[model samples]
Target: MASPRELTTPATLTEESVRRYREDGFVHVPRLLSPEEVSVYRAAAESILERDMEVWAGGDDGAAVEVNYTTQVWRKDETLRRLALHPALTGIAGRLAGVPLRLYSSEVLVKEPEGAPPTLLHDDEAGLPMDGLEQTLTAWIALVDVPVERGCLSYIPGSHLRADSERLRHMTSFEQFREPDEVWPDFPWRPRVTVPLRAGDVAFHHCRTLHWAGGNETDARRVGHGVIYMDAGTTYLPGVMDEYLAHMEPGQPLDDAELFPIVTS
Candidate 1:
């Protein structure tokens, strides 16, 4: 088990654990940080909720929402910035990506109590418009205790290695990600697995993994941080990309230090 203060320090990832990521496309790393250490991160999250955050909102303006998924929280405060650049994540990303990784973005995905809407099955890569779509993933760390009842994620094992990945790659929208297993009847995947984690436990997942979280059935809120990691030197794809890319140059590579600095090299 990791001590509270050792939260920022990198853990020695075992070969077997790395192999799990290679094969399954997702692995839950235990004791990534202690609950005491996670308090600071929780504070950061609370601070974010306290203000008018420039959150993506996941289509909900405020009321009658599915989940209060917010983005760019790292841009607002110091604790969030530290969590985004934490060396522990980069160390793991270096091993997983087999190349230096950069911070793509940091977000808070919160599911409020009283049956918050479930997250429909979807992959992070298809939603992102990067040309090197496969060169990215999300490092998720639960900010609070997350059981299946509290909106934890469930992933279809080995779906990232599917043959019809291209078809699964660029979905027009999350609503459009109807069960791919049905579309490609031959899609190779085992039954989905629901991830359960306490505060500070982490899960690393490939960008293309078909995953979803159930509605929050518990009385408390479910919250976690997703720090985006992209392999260095990925570029923007113009026409097929999301609306956010309208500001950047069409052919520009996303290697900007100020925005997407190298987390590991």
Candidate 2:
């Protein structure tokens, strides 16, 4: 386990890992957080979800939502904010991206045992409200050990190389309302790489990489923190987050310190 001071220090990445990210569009980093760090984050996340978050249900059944997420969590809890801005996290993200990055958003995701459904396979680029989409990525940090049966993430290797226009078209036309196994008949299929992580492990994937997670079968909840990082000059576009970024011009760069701060050491 890393000492408290070491947890705040910038993480070191190897050339092999950077190369893997460039070629595969995803890379896993082991022990990104210490055991002590995980305990603190897990407690903070659980408390925030229970007390502050209003989890939204996806279906029209009007069922009471008891699991899932709160977006931009960094803006709510100081402890979670520290996790988002942690030097190790930002440093690893910057290194993997091979460029300066700006924080786009951070979310806490939870999949309850036995009840949560499997997340569908999709690329973030299909839904993101940003220009220069190629330069965006997400770092998913596990707060607890996530085995295959406990909702670990899986990705189609190198799928990020596909054209963005095609992905968006297919997503809008065919994937809007379907189950995880359901997809457009012509959608290209590839073998997936399932990534199981220890409590402190983190996996970084390109925004365009096709990915999904399995439902938790174990008794414990599968909790994760995902932080999206984009190129420093990424500009705003009209979409899901329009209300939040309404102050900025349609094509304006998202440089606001409060919402989209630069990830620095």
Candidate 3:
């Protein structure tokens, strides 16, 4: 495995990079992780899938055959956690958010070859009902090389600054909210860029950026992981409109513990 130093570099996002992000609402950081690191993560993912295949296959009776999100893979899987909180990625997120960042959530989204549905199109903030324009950032890391034809990500640049419209619809996954005509009426709704990524490349997007991913038509699998980061001062809105500050545990603040445990006052 590559040393942590290779993966974690303390560099500021360039002016052009920041400008492009503000203009397009997203930026792609190519080769963020070494091939060795990528391989480690890939092996970890496969191990997880193997252990959970019974559950994935809908274990025992027919009752277990339902498709559900699995948090266990992340909680127990060391490699996933390591990659999720990689310093280089979090440092960039911290810079973007303008506050100390915390791991909001970690998830692995795998689209199997053929027959899988596209993820709904919507902003990340749509899931959390909070007023004001405070932004949350998401780092999407590809575990395997992905081509445009094999379900790479598509985005509408600079759409994050726009107000949330009725065009935004609620769905179980991010891909369902896509209605290109409703979101972009002027131009022919073609993506300016199709992010074809090598393994370990990361794409960072603002919370409100408009993006979507299509179904995988290839015979191979398309797997990616997402790690969301929120600025330090950001409050977690539990239940309804009530805001609760995060309380951190000693050195564990930098690492994932629970949801913002320490609310710095």
Candidate 4:
């Protein structure tokens, strides 16, 4: 395995990259990690998975199928924490956001074999009171190869810039948006492109990007680990933000606590 510095270049996002992002709502960054780093994190995750299975009883497929390991990884895994704060990503995030960035949270999303369901298409901002678009972003890193047949992510290009009314109709989750079919009755469901990623590739998407991941149809599992980033000066929405902040001690900033601990300043 190569060092992260050796594996990734110092990404200087161009106007075209920014323009594409503004127009498409997301961009796929290829080969963001070296094979070595990918292996380290995957092994760490596999260790946790094995432990979870051993400690917990009753290996019912349905119960095991729905599991999503996230918070625990951030709390106990150093390798994952390092990956969350990788310089290549944070620098690009800062440039894209035009401000200092802080890691908001990290999660491990595992779409189990065969029985996993399709995730609803929606924007992250629908559930929060964000004042503007540039304040929040997400870096979704693929830990294994993901093909469309194996439940790769699909997005509606340029939909991030759509009006609230138009956007709302495409979201169907508790996140406060309608399903895509409801919004675009005449539009065909064909994806613009199926984002195929190698183990180390990462995709950076805006908070408002309308995206979804289908179920894992193959025998092998599809897994992604996401580290959400927010511009340092961004404020938290009062009601919904309170739930995550409640666990913090008085006077402690939200980024300083365990839940949204700042992996990078």
- Tell me the TM-score of model 2: 0.87
Predictions in order: lDDT = 0.77, 0.80, 0.63, 0.65
For all predicted structures, in order, the TM-scores are 0.87, 0.87, 0.72, 0.76
Better structure of 1 and 4 per TM-score: 1
After best superposition, candidate 2 residue 164: deviation in angstroms? 3.4
Write the residue-wise lDDT of candidate 4 on 18-83 in tens digits: 667767878787777778888888887766665553222213554544435555456567887787
Better of 2 and 3 by lDDT: 2
Stretches of candidate 3 off by over 4 Å are: 1-8, 52-69, 72-74, 129-133, 164-192, 238-257, 261-265
Ten consecutive residues with minimal summed lDDT in candidate 4? Answer: 53-62
Give me the runs in candidate 4 sitting further than 4 Å from their true place: 1-8, 12-15, 50-67, 128-133, 169-177, 180-191, 238-242, 247-265
Q: Which TM-score value belongs to model 4?
A: 0.76
Error of 1 at 229 (Å): 0.1
Q: Which 10-residue span in candidate 3 carries the lowest summed lDDT?
A: 237-246
Candidates 1 and 2, the one with greater lDDT: 2
Model 1 residue pairs with clashes: none
RMSD of each candidate?
Answer: 3.1, 3.8, 7.1, 5.4
